[model samples]
Target: MFRKLIEDASTWHWWREWMLIFLGCIMMGTAFVFFINPYKFVPGGVYGLGIVLHNIFPSIQVGTFGYMLDVPLMIVALLVFGGQFGARTVAAALFTPGYMNLLTRAVYPNEAAVESLDPALLLNGQLNLSDDLLLTAIMGAVIIGVGQGIVVRQQATTGGTDIVAMLLQKFAGIKFSTGILLADGAVVLAGLLVIGFGLGTGEAGEKGWVLTLYSLITIFTTSRVIAYVLDGASYDKLLFINSDHHDELRRFIIEDLDRSATYIKARGMYTGNEREMIFLVISRKEVRQVQHKIKEIDPRAFLVVTDAYDTFGEGFKPFPSADVMQAE
Candidate 1:
């Protein structure tokens, strides 16, 4: 068993997975160092909590707090999710904080050393772009989303809230995405209370509501980006057809579109006529071709096309196995 484990760990695929995780950690760390942390925006997850805590305790680094939190969470993951998730989650959890600390040091060595929230401006205010909350929100979302998407695609995550979300998914029978939303929602609310209300005293006079709205925007953007990266963009179209020339349309779909179709026998209630209904799913790019073929076959053919958010099968995304762990 030990030898086999060693062999599996030495494989190219294993190294590739670790490398992708490292890259993801770097991107996430960069997002925190340059955008999320400095701008005081909470994008959710454990790091969001870290951000709020860092504000209260200016002496502690956000990444350090993240590291402290991740240790226990990774332990919980080991017990709940087994070894695969445990090992990778450990790597990701460690790497994220280390990279965040390293990047902060490299960019703002003096500020990082001081343990303060005095705005680590790049090049003596030359590159300090933390003023615009909207820009920071969007940029941080995209960067963190892509980083997270990459890690999630590799069947791992940066740990923290991801572990909690996964545990909820396992025990509560909730959707992974919904679990993430719930976990992140709580973190964002906490951030609002801390930053906006100044630790519930409302004495800080901060724009807590506005910050909450920004956090919502960040969550929406990140979710959309993650979906695009994982299941692909909303480029799938589902077609439902009621046509007289079923044979021609079937042939066109099979031969021309290089796609398959399912046919069902149906009856029109008003006309009391038996009909053949066809159902097909194709990429959005193929819409024009399908329309052209349908028009040629029967101009008056009844067709309805709607967006397909996630289509998993032979032509689309394959189902994730147990190895493909989702992150919050």
Candidate 2:
């Protein structure tokens, strides 16, 4: 019985999912502690609110505020979404903030420094771009986007404004994307007033609008990264090859590249000669390999390669469910 339990724990799926969560939380933690929190940029989400609240209450770290917001959101998600969420969602929500707190402390010399956000401590003073908020916005956005993407890829949703977005989708009949934009926009507006316009903080609001602009840039950049990660982008290429060495190239593809190809009976439009055309999909890197091999095999071969955006198959992304495809 003990060995059986151990074997079940050691299964590939169990470790792989946990690894995703662990790595993703680390990414988010670093981004919050280093880029987003220090600058008071409200990039939207509970953490964005965290930054706003942290400005008002410097005693509490941004991740601590994230913890404060996430709990209620998770509870609401549980009541509303029910079986839609699993352990991974709960774990990711609870873990990321605590990790961020740790990172904040680790980087700063003390709590006072953390609150002040001393420039020298942030990213070893290499990324303290106080004078360059635009670059910092982009950096934070890309990091957090990739982090959130990794978590989402593993079927885990961090219970932040994602829950609010879904709630809007459910009760108000708003689209999910629109709901997210509205929620984040509200947060950004809140930041503009709280931190930018100087509502309830010690900071001055004279130059707050500029930070608001940078916050929007962060939001836009993060969305692009998340979209790239979720959609997998156009990293793969589709190719069609017509060459006398079809058999040899096919063999190379199968044996060397360990990739499969399809053969289509074709006749040239002008020549009217019948032959087998090699059709295949491969990654951008593998395209160069195929090109080099083709050149070696038949210098005069007719080959065409094009971007294969969002390919779904055995080696690529799995096909979405029927409902998802229909929505697409």
Candidate 3:
């Protein structure tokens, strides 16, 4: 029994998901401590709110606020999503904030360290600052986005706004994307008022609307990066094949490509001849195989390939489940 347990723990499949989750959380925590939190850059999430609150209450660490906020959200997730919410997600939600706190202490040990990095820190509750806001926004966004994307891909989350988004979707019938936009948008706008505008009271106040604009840039960059990382690049290709050898091409697609196709009948504009056209969505990598096979079957086959996004269904991403409301 002991050896069986040990063997199970040693399996790559058993450990891979947890390892990735831990790494993803660490990456996200590093982004927040070293980049986002230090700048008061609100990229929109619970952590964004934590940044605003931390500015108001300097004694409290942002990650502590994150932990406080996440607990209730995790409860919401458990109640709404049931067992599908899973212990791993709960672990992620709890660990990320604590990890962020650890990183913050490690990276920015003292006021002197903060000031040495960016004098902007003097104004923002002794935060470690960056010289270039644009660079910080871009780099932070990429790291955080990729980290969050990896966690999400592993069927877990760091909780926070993800739970709220799921709640909105569950009760209000709002779509996850729209719910996320509303929730994150509200946080970012609130950050603009609380941190960016600052009521002419602090360093961020002096930075003014520019800080809000930078936050917007960060949010946009983060969203793009998350989408790119979560959705494989291969899924972007949509192939249109007009082939005389429909049977042969279809057989190749079914047997070799192991993909499905939709057929539509249309008449040629100039020739006034009716023809059957095959439409299929495939990964970019499979385009070459399809092309070669079509050439072998029908040299004169007309082929058109276009970029596509949000491809969901068989052989691709399924619709997001309530439990899988991914977080940033």
Q: What does candidate 3's lDDT look like per residue over 277-324, in tens digits?
A: 998998878888878888888999999999876677888878766445
The 10-residue segment of model 2 with minimum total lDDT is 319-328
RMSD of each candidate?
A: 3.5, 5.6, 4.8
| Residue lDDT tens for model 1, 20-135 | 98898888888888777876678788888898888788778889989988888888988877788778888999989988877776676486543554454544455466568888
lDDT of 1: 0.79
Q: Which lDDT tens digits does candidate 2 get at residues 68-186?
A: 99988888767765554647778899999889888888888776888877666775787677887777889889998888777766666676876776677567777444556678998
Winning model by lDDT: 2
Clash pairs, model 3 backbone: none
Q: How many backbone clashes does candidate 1 have?
A: 0
Error of 2 at 113 (Å): 1.3
Better of 1 and 2 by lDDT: 2
Ranking by lDDT: 2, 1, 3
lDDT of 2: 0.81
List TM-score per model, in order: 0.89, 0.70, 0.76
- Least accurate stretch of 10 residues (summed lDDT) in model 1? 113-122
